[model samples]
Target: MRLIDSYRDKKTVDILLTQIGNINVKHKYRFMEVCGTHTMSISRFGLRTLLPENINLISGPGCPVCVTSQGEIDAIFDLVKNNDVIIATYGDLLKVPGSNGENLYMLRSIGFDVRVIYSPLDVISIAKNTGKEVVFLSIGFETTTPASAALVKQLVKENIKNVSLFVMNKTMPRVLDFIANQKEVMVDGFLCPGHVSAITGERLYEPLVKSGFACVISGFEPVDILMSVKLLMEQVNKGKFWVENNYGRVVKSNGNELAMKLMYEVFEDCDACWRGIGIIGKSGLKLRDNYKEYDAIERFNIFIDYDKSLPGCRCGDVLLGRINPTDCSFYGKRCTPDNPFGPCMVSNEGSCAAYYKFGG
Candidate 1:
């Protein structure tokens, strides 16, 4: 069998599922998988249905677009409406609505130059070809931040003057810390994000383990996820809490050090607002003082202020794993993929989107 197919082998998946089922845990256990891909994987594979009733797999603030504050979304819309610059961002962000229900897709239809880019490096060509200022809407966790950092470094080294970054890049650890302490949700352990762990390493979650939480860095495949759950069950069975590297093939103890160094060189920590979870301390990345020339907010003289109230929208609760997407009153009615009432419904990786699409 091919190496990629080995992770999807049904026999191995069933074996891991049996192993997870054999664990003799009497109490209820809630484990949150804090990645958009993991959420999608779980929903797509129907892993939750195979698990025992004692175990609950919850979704956290993993979707970058979903967690971005409405104020920032409004800021991006305002930037496009008032300025004559090219706006480039990821495709998932195209449909996300501002506080006033305006989005880049709508703006693009009305003659705004909004382009959907697959990579951060794509903006360089757009800026060079158009001979106009291009502001890239950069957003993601540690996994995608290095690429954005690399883009900034390249722009600086080449003295590219027309491109700037509207950075909404967020770090995972601080927000994880916030989630760990919140009483609204009960997370006994974390099925840590494989992609982010590959960038930040296993050591980043050591503090949470020290604080008495089970953590297993998990991959996205069926067997990989099942094995991760088996590892977490082992911890619960033994009454021991530790960081288990179930995804060691990609994640290292120290992570990709060079990538992290590149990221920190261009960005610094700042307080950031999560869409439904309020402001988290030092959970986000901003361009460093030396790289301030590439900051879109500063260049355009824009202010970001979040409108925290999303009346009747329980997206925040879904993000926190306090409630499921189906529990929301407007989830299937007012909130759908085509017409999203909240950001969670807009992004493919979002919990609401996952549940809605796959019936989780």
Candidate 2:
């Protein structure tokens, strides 16, 4: 059958659902997908409604912007407010409210001089051409880190001094470890993120599998998601835990080594704070000492007094899979994309945003 025809084939979905129902899960299984894109796609396709009631899917700390600490946002604003510096960041990060009802986009509107760039490469060009101190508000997972690292390498090669990177890069493994240790939530398995797996590889998730939880790296397509759920159910029924790569076409065991090498060369693991989750050790990436010249924090001597999240925001619980979007008192009420109370509702990849956009 053609790709378009197959997607609309309800019979195919019925067969998959039937197979899923036939497989004895033995115990209740809760699988978490730690990527915001995964959450959006799953919701958009109504994947949750198709699953067995016994099987639960939860959203994790996958959205980079949503998980970014308020202190970091404050720090970015600190840099922006300085007349000597020009801030460059992704568009989605503009609306994430910081401590004191301040956001990058708001600062920009008030003449703080913030420019949104689609790619780090663009920021590099901007830095090279302008005399102003350009700080790229770098934030993302492994997928976006390589490009940021590449830009750093280019700046070093060209001996550019104006460009600096505020590295808020997060790794998936450490965050997953933190989530597994949380007693408030129980995750039986993980539908690993495809883009992140493509950078860190399937091997990186070995520890999670060894801990008796099944890990499957699946794609965003409907069939891919259904197939992953079926595979997880089969593994749970058989009393087996392993890392399975359902997205074999894009992800490999070792992943993109070149990208990994670039990341290590420029950044090192450090203790970084998540907005509501506090600090997770070795969860964040910072610029290496050798490349400190390109580090934004050091270049600007930026200091941020860590700010506590606003009251009535359950973003921390939402990110840790302990609560869903509806559980938050502010969800779809006081908080929304237009008037966000927390970063979870502000970011495009956030679970609350996904639920609001698609029908939660």
How high a TM-score does candidate 2 get?
Answer: 0.95
Cα lDDT tens digits, model 2, 62-104, are 9999898777777777677765788888988989887778788
lDDT tens readout by residue for model 1, 204-311: 898898887899999999999988888887787687898999998999999999999999999999988998888899999999999999999999998888765567
What are the lDDT figures for the candidates, one per model?
0.90, 0.86
The numbered model that scores best in TM-score is 1
Which ten residues in a row are the worst by lDDT in model 1? 304-313
Q: List the residue pairs that clash in candidate 2.
A: none
Model 1 Cα displacement at 152 (Å)?
A: 1.2
TM-score against truth, every candidate = 0.98, 0.95
Task: State the local distance difference test value for candidate 1.
Answer: 0.90
| Highest lDDT against the true fold, candidate | 1
